[model samples]
Target: MMMTMATAAAVAVEDSTTDDVQPLSTLKMQAAQVAMDSGAVIHASPDVLGKNGEDSAWVTVNVTAPSPSAGHWVALFSPADFGYGLPSYLLVYMFANVSPSFMSSGSGNLRFLVINQRSDYAFGLFSGGKDNPKLIAISNKVSFANSKAPVFPRLSQGKEWNEMAVTWTSGYNINEAYPFVEWKMKGGESSKRTPAGTLTYTRRHLYSYQIGHELPDGTVVWGKSSTFRASPFPGQDSLQRVVVFGDMGIGQRDGSNELAGFQPGAQVTTDRLIKDLPNYDAVFHIGDLSYSNGFLAQWDQFTAQIEPIASKVPYMVASNVVVLCRCSGNHERTYQDTGGFYNGNDSRGECGVPAETYFYVPAENRGKFWYAADHGMFRFCVGDRCFSSVDRKHQPWLVFAAHRPLGYSSNDYYATEGSFSEPMGRTLQGLWQKHRVDLAIYGHVHNYERTCPVYENTCMDGKSKQDKGSYSGAMGGTIHVVAGTGGAKLRDYSAGPSPQWSVVRDKSFGYVKLTATDHSSLRVEFIHSDDGAAHDAFDITRDYKDVLACTVDSCAPHTMAN
Candidate 1:
């Protein structure tokens, strides 16, 4: 997730070594030198794709180069007319050396998993390396059967607990075709239709739906059908499970883009979530989703990667930038003279515009990039750049989440800074303590670590290993959990001795699951994505009275005379 577009002719560089080397960033695209070769021919088969209502399809590319070298490579570009102008998107690239016999045979065949990105595509052969790519061959145009078809339905909870919001991507506008969702209760006799931008829900019933664009001629361009269960009523006492993680970048199934590097465990974790989809009711990908940086097409690849899970559950998201006052990754927000706190060019020319445009959340103002959501007994104050007050009586579990480690983390870089968190992260300490926040979760360190119930650098509870895994009564402080193990290369903990407040640390690719059995108890587990097993876990047993009890600065003042 730590990657971004270059601001100029050179690639953007960051202080951290963990920045993902975006495959698309390797090319000197702006100043590319053209040397079209007649002997070198490039072609892609099954040019017309998505013929079976599929949003994505596999295409085979054949390359014949009279003179090939190790530096030779290929690129996928959209809006096919790459020679006239820069392609709208440089979708993906791979080295010609991938084929074992490519150098000797002067020909190679490669498989690519291409999604319908609302544009036609062309494959280009390059003679020189990424730094001085010389386009030698251009393939014929390839496109989906209906490039404007509505697709990639992403689910999110509406402002109301019983309401579900569905957002999707389509090439059509309201004037071209009316967008709507046709749905029905799983067992209902008749189905009903709701306009695309409207809410659709009824209690916790499972509903099946199809998103489509209704043409003026009464025809329809339908996307894949999917099903989802509505959120339970607010504070409803039931077994509620939630999946939380961060920093998951895109993975290539065909292995075309991995040569330059990508999130190695992204597909594994994505498949795990899909396999375990029946268990969790919702997901909170706190930040760094897609890691598109400024490569716009990668966003489509990321959405298609998570479609199986997002299309089913409420796939909540947050920004990856500074948690307190920022709402997206430095790669999404930081640009020279943009007024972002971080003074850099990590986002190339994009200043949070693409991310804000691509995703939908329950935030009051999408520009603010913060929101409050309720799932049964849990109340989540997600990505609030400012302190947002909440009523904790009904939803007894008050949790706060943001992208960076705003509370605590012994990440080596943060350790060097002596803050144990992103600079200014602890600004929320007063708010969390005053509001009695139970848990504060974060991602961005690219590892898993859980602190003891702690405040102000002190472990408020569980000082002994024997007492570490469980808690009860009026827990005095918030438990900070970092679950940034969603596939980007795992980072190392500080080389120094483990901090006392640090209860557990694991450098595994996994996610955190919080299961609320009832208002009286909560079970938290760190489940490894590989085996789907809980490697670290803890429990909190308390009651409504416990939540009301004073802890540190949590309670209001009272007069003893009373």
Candidate 2:
């Protein structure tokens, strides 16, 4: 295992002419750029790490520079867009002279066992845009003096049905092994465990792991919007009861922890999910699943806290990624402890990595967070507008989820930090409009809000609230909903008359429930997770006459070429 972790990976950038790097036709990650500094050039390549007639398809990572040469070796991930930063770039092995370990591979590469225990890491949502790694360390530390806990989080490939990458965080150098997951039909009895495969997520650096006491100083950097998060499979085709909301605080890492005494929004929601298990099938957390900015423990606490509900229903994550990743305003780079504040990726201790590790034990037995990633929210076309029915299973709707609000939102502090609309929101507005999206969901701003059926940033269909919410028409305008009231600190609508586009807005600890009524009819209601009050709602009747529908068969999940 130690030998495989070292210099066994493939792909190293070489001079334009002759080189030893293998062909790039089939590999998912190929080194495409090499920036030289101080006469020192970086070199590395991948070699199959399979053993005993078995093929794991895994490769070794090789790094090298001329010996006795006057310079430092630096290998940068390429296209300057793959988002390859330290978090995703794990330096498991280093060449002999540049060693940082007690052992070396047969090929002379030093090996690194990055994480040791659950208390030692954290990874955030896909916060590092373009250069976002799958995971990163939030707190890299090992404690023989104190007992610690870990977290579990399994991400859907975000591009395929029933496909997920279940990962565990926190394995010590002494106890090295990856977590395993066993899944079957929701109602099936017993099944064998399926290895979701283990990935060495770490702090981005020459020696990615924490070395004794130095504490990792870089964030992992995986680039470009490679894939989507998780969601339920084929649920779009049936009449499924779904929960929609964002900003479910994982509890504050700062001294004030709502989980200790207060009823956190996530807890309230979990309590409700328990009592009303049959009433829903999945959850769509638009954004802020865990507010574990830098405190990796928060990720552990939040997943453990929501186990009851998330285990049974699919909890989908939006905002973690964007459509096509055209810009950087996805909100992952803001927080001081995580994100771009990661100080050049030297270290991103925990972007929310522990959730994967701590939960794997019991999480394997009790059920874990669920959600599949589907990126078919909108369809863009030029002269002759195009609209495709999304679910071939006769499901007729297109719902969009994001962390930040694109329209009909009261903005305040986020803009100052460059998260609200500088990039993501504005970048998506046109795409949403072009596709004539039906429902748009968000959570970053912590408050519950619903906009009048709107299009082109205008409240085209005005607003009306029957005993249940009602909209004038369906296909013409896109309804925008914000349920950020998920237990974190609440914020007031900006200090001014509510925007005309906003129909119902409230400051409450709640979430929105969406029901796909039929081919042309869908209903959405915002319910306070605290008390069972149906605070707000709206229904859309598919014009059937004009909405373009993308058949489920026609729209395979989105995949990244790189």
lDDT of each: 0.79, 0.41
What TM-score, computed on C-alpha atoms, does each candidate reach? 0.93, 0.53
Q: What C-alpha lDDT, on a 0 to 100 scale, does residue 558 get in candidate 2?
A: 68
Best by lDDT: 1
lDDT of 2: 0.41
Which tens-of-lDDT digit does each residue in 1-562 have in candidate 2?
0101100111121111122111111122233222222322222222212122111122222333333211111122211222324333321111233433212321223222221222222111111112322211121111212112122232322234434444323223323433234333323334334433422222111111111111134322111111122333443444556677776655323222224222256566667666776776556665556545343434444554564455444444544334322111122223223333112211123332332333221111112222223422221111111234344234346666655565557655433433233244665555565556667777767778777656555665544443226643334566777777776566666666665666787888887887765555667888877777787766766555445543222223567973
Residue-pair clashes per candidate: 0, 78
The window of 10 residues in a row where model 2 has the poorest summed lDDT is 1-10
For candidate 1, lDDT tens digit of each residue in 326-420?
45765566666655555666666677777777667778777657788888888888754333455566688888887778889998767876645
